[model samples]
Target: MIRVHIARQFDVRAADGRRLNAEELHAEGERLMQSLLDLEQCNDDFCDSVTATDADKGTVLVELLISDETETGAFEKSRTIVRTAIHAIGGATPWEASADLGADYRPRDVQLEYV
Candidate 1:
């Protein structure tokens, strides 16, 4: 089995073009983390664990551990799972996400925009 570490950073923003206050930001971060955790529960075949390491300054940091037969499969699966979690949250617009895979692989950057 291949173990891959994925870190995703999300720049969360309100739909009305206003910055979210600290309280709102924290709530949003929690929601996002919960969404990921929920997904992890269903995707046991590939996802090993999901963690919300930080949520502050209009950004949410999520770390994911995925195991698969190949590195490419793990990376792609991680991206799909994260995108699904983001979409599941809903309401948050113009979300931007970038990811860093662990040391052996080059970082895979992804941008997500909700219309």
Candidate 2:
């Protein structure tokens, strides 16, 4: 099995007198996750899972996990899928995401695990 991880963080401000809640964070995360899931035309089951964690610095961390067979082509396909997904959410230019980039997340630092 091969495991791929992708994470992104964003800082959101309260609109009106209400504060951002877990539900709202989840909705955004889900939307982003779907956009990512659509990549590679892999199966919907390949989505694995997505998580939105609240950060200490008032940031929202979105994590995506996708699993597939162990193969070089699969890895490259996953990389293409991940890169396109992140750029779409952040921006086409790398610098556009400098501010909202996840603290522990690096789009170029993808990890491949074989088991």
Whose TM-score is greatest here? 1
How do the residues 15-48 of candidate 2 rate in per-residue lDDT, one tens digit apiece?
Answer: 3323456665555456557666565365542455
Model 1 weakest 10-residue run by lDDT: 98-107
Residue pairs with clashing backbones, model 2: none
Clashes of 2: 0
Q: Give per-residue CA lDDT, model 1, range 1-115, as digits (tens).
A: 7666766665555654456667776776677678877887777754544434233455655567777777677767777776666667763323343232111111234432211
Q: What's model 2's TM-score?
A: 0.41
Model 2 ranges with Cα > 4 A deviation: 1-28, 40-45, 49-54, 57-71, 93-109
- 28 Cα displacement, candidate 2 (Å): 5.1
